[model samples]
Target: MFDKIYDVIVVGAGHAGGEAAAAAANMGSSTLLITMNLQNIGQMSCNPAMGGIAKGQIVREIDALGGYSGIISDETAIQFKMLNKSKGPAMWSPRVQSDRMRFSEEWRLKLERTPNLDFYQEMVGGIVVEDGKIVGVKTSLGLTARGKTVVLTNGTFLNGLIHIGDKQFGGGRAGERASTGITKELTDLGFETGRMKTGTPPRVDGRSLDFSKMEVQPGDVDPEKFSYSSSTKPLTKQRDCHLSYTSPQVHEMLKEGFDRSPMFNGSIKSIGPRYCPSIEDKINRFADKDRHQLFVEPEGWNTVEYYINGFSTSLPEDIQFRALREVAGFEQVKFFRPGYAIEYDYFPPTQLKHTLETKLVSGLFFAGQINGTTGYEEAASQGLMAGINAALLVQEKDPFILKRNEAYIGVLVDDLITKGTEEPYRMFTSRAEYRTLLRQDNADFRLTPKGYDLGLASEERLREMEIKQKKSDAFVGFFTNTSVPPEVLNPILESKDSALVTQSDKMIRPFSRPNITMDDMRKIETVEAFIRENELDTEVLQQAEIQIKYAGYIEKEKNNAEKLNRLEGIKIPENFDYTRLKSLSYEATEKLSKIRPVTVSQASRISGVSPNDISVLLVYMGR
Candidate 1:
């Protein structure tokens, strides 16, 4: 069955593998996606939701780069909400409550529709490396599939061990089989491996939940979808989620099972996510808190299954049932399945380059859980880059790397390679230095051209971005150039209790005021006429408004980013010995020698590397 030497081979068809395969194949590579089970392609392994906070920016980046996660998420979403609307544009994020089943279905359909991609059901045990380059993968069946490059996205499946309190079993997920052989193979090949654990909350029957007892958490009044493409649309209607809380009584019930908790006991030694901790861990750590919030989210539009968000646990089944039933909405909660903690193998990402390619093995790449990152969005971004780079490598083209200022994806990659994570690394908006410049709204403006040039993003995608850019630019230009008389601006300002202008002013000045919005400006006859005549939509108008309002802050961030780019451009010799620099601190020398950052900008970001160390490099290089 494996005759031809393909361009790319992607193992483990979770979020990362799916995107990786699609990217490579879409870029005209003969890409093969192999998984343990083909039926579970694009499965939502943890939560039935996509994008939140900083994560929403990443999904848009993926979409902007022609990846399918945003499109699939939008199509399958049962609910949508743009988070942080009260905040600035930089903090604004788009998230979706997905129909879990449909999300997976849509992903499979998209992959099937894609060109130059093939699927096979197999657990890849190890890669066949030749001379320091990945040649192919060897499956569990002892069969070899040849490819120029191989991407390992084995998300939480490698050596997986699940613990439901005292009971433990070998399984990747609840029902799925655990994968073996790959970790051993990689370890023998000199790669370091670590154990990390993560837990999921129990799924309950919606019929069993008492929504009247809990606070209603309804979807947004005007929901926005994930995809920037025309392929999907926003949900016209949305399902409501409920908010419940754990009490002192619930905590006591949960404490009964802590003795048997894999996390609490010696059963599990792996580090779990710091942010998304287990229920037992939460209570154990934050003992002073009277209650913890739990979101009762629907799994899908049609299913009876509802996810118990913020209630993740690995306690005994009886204890889980007893404690959950004590919660506000879960008065008579009947579990579909008890929550369990799963420990799995992960390879530290310092071994990977910015492109997600392994530095030791030329054509080998690692993405998803294999890289010790946590979220679905994070995994997908890595896969997209890895698949792209794999294809580019086969085509003998230059590698693609998004700069720190340009994308959150760039920040994610740079952080992982620069400072290797000890626990499951989750992305936060605070991690990004230039969050103001990397707004979700302008992802297409930043990445579509680059995606198009790589032959990954479609021409139609580029045209859409171009058209949006043109319209918004014109609208902003109008705002900058057009002046409105006091009569037109004063009336609107007075209504909002803002200072009334005594004289005529450029419309942009009034529009930039916090009290003014596009709607307020539209009241001006000329502004309304311009919008109508130009046939501008909500998106373009909003885009123009942001540019006008945040121009100063945006300009400041851009300037700062440019200054950082000077260091980014200063190349570090690949194998330069930091030990030779007598002025460098011991910590900086050790870190720089181990991480081997390609540029001074990257070196400066290292945890131990200080300002003085950066100056040493500059002086040594005669900069």
Candidate 2:
């Protein structure tokens, strides 16, 4: 039945697969997306939310790079929040509570409307390999399809095993059947496979819970969206989430099922997410805590189901219900389903290149949970990168790889391939060394140009980014050239408890004070007139202010990054015999050989390779 070979075939249709397919097809590749069930494409398997902490910045980065995640998230968002607003701009992250059904519907609709893309409903059973390269895929229904390149984004589906208390079942998700064949086949072909576990809290009927006892958690008063696209509407109305605490009584009840709990009973052998541990695990780990916080989030605008966040567990249904009822707001909670944990197969990311293509197989790539990452945003970013690289490979173009200082996507891929995660990897602002330069406010400024050059980003997007940059730069120049007298600046500074200026100086001088802000400066008639004359927008003004205020720190970080990038510029030959270097330590030799690092910088990041080893290599290369 397979007549023509596709340029790219993407397996699975979750966040990772959807982004991958869209990226490839949008880049002019003839792409096919195969899923076990098409109806569940882009389903939010765990919670009805997108973006949080560093994950939110990742969504914006994805949007800035011509990916659909931010656009879809904005379209489906029921509430919007810019987390860490109290902190610096570098820490600011935009998150959304989405309409569960709408999020999936938007994804499917977009994928359907995309050009050069086709969809098929089938479980990929095996891959057809020819001379160390992927040629096609075999389906469970005795059908085969050919493709030049294939991206596997099979999230939580490879030999998936679900656990609920002492009961176990084989399933990819709560209502989805587990996929087989490919994991075993890949392992047989010399891929090292490992198991990882993740869990979701139980879905409960919202109407059954008493909201009066819970604390109201409202959305931001002045909310913003994820997408940089003008087509996305701003959120004017928002649903309020509730916060309730699991009391000591609730913990006691949860502990009663500890013996039967799959996590503690030895039924689950895989490691779970370290940041979002199970409810049972939390209580056991922190015995002295009197209560734990749970945010009761709505599933959708119309649905009666609510997600019991922070209460994830694999305890028995009876135990789950009883323990939840003891919580403040969940005194009469009714269950939609009990919480469960699932363990799935993942390949160690060290076996892949920065482009996400496997080292052992040509034209074969992996993304999302298959690479041992844990969030929707994280998965989507990986998919977008993998898809872009795969399409470029088929077109005989150089692979697209982001540098660590450029985007969080780069930091994530680098950490995975260089260090190789033992536990599931999740992104955090603290993870980036040059975070000040990698702020969410400047993602478009940083990456939209690259996306535009790749044909994934539109001319319109590039134009918008250029305009923003020009205006911000002009504002900064104005601040540097203009002098503000004490009469114009002292009143504003004193009102904000900042020291009064003695004489007229460049506007940027006073603007650098910690207590002073652009708003305070705008209060001055001269500054207001200047803003009106220049037609500066709030975003432009803010960007300029931050640049001036943090100029010292930003330049310091840039210098540090430049020094490290020198090592990165030194390319190491592929398959170089590290063992031949007798001066290197055994541990360093083993790690360097196994990782086969593409650059001297990547080799330096490997655990066993120290700074001395890097110096040794640099000396050898110098000779």
Please give, for residues 138-250, the per-residue lDDT of candidate 2 as tens digits: 99997999999999999999999999988999999998999999998899889999999999999999999999999999999988888877889779999999999998899
Give per-model TM-scores. 0.99, 0.99
Work out candidate 2's RMSD over C-alphas: 1.0
Over 41-137, each residue of candidate 1 has an lDDT whose tens digit, in order, gives 9999888999999999999999999999999998888888899999999999999999999999989999999999988998888889889888999
lDDT value, candidate 2, whole model: 0.93
* Backbone collisions counted per model: 0, 0
Candidate 2 positional error at 509, Å: 1.0
lDDT of 2 at 156: 98
- Model 1 alpha-carbon miss at residue 449, Å: 0.7
C-alpha lDDT (0 to 100) for residue 541 of candidate 1 = 90
lDDT of every model, 2 decimals? 0.92, 0.93
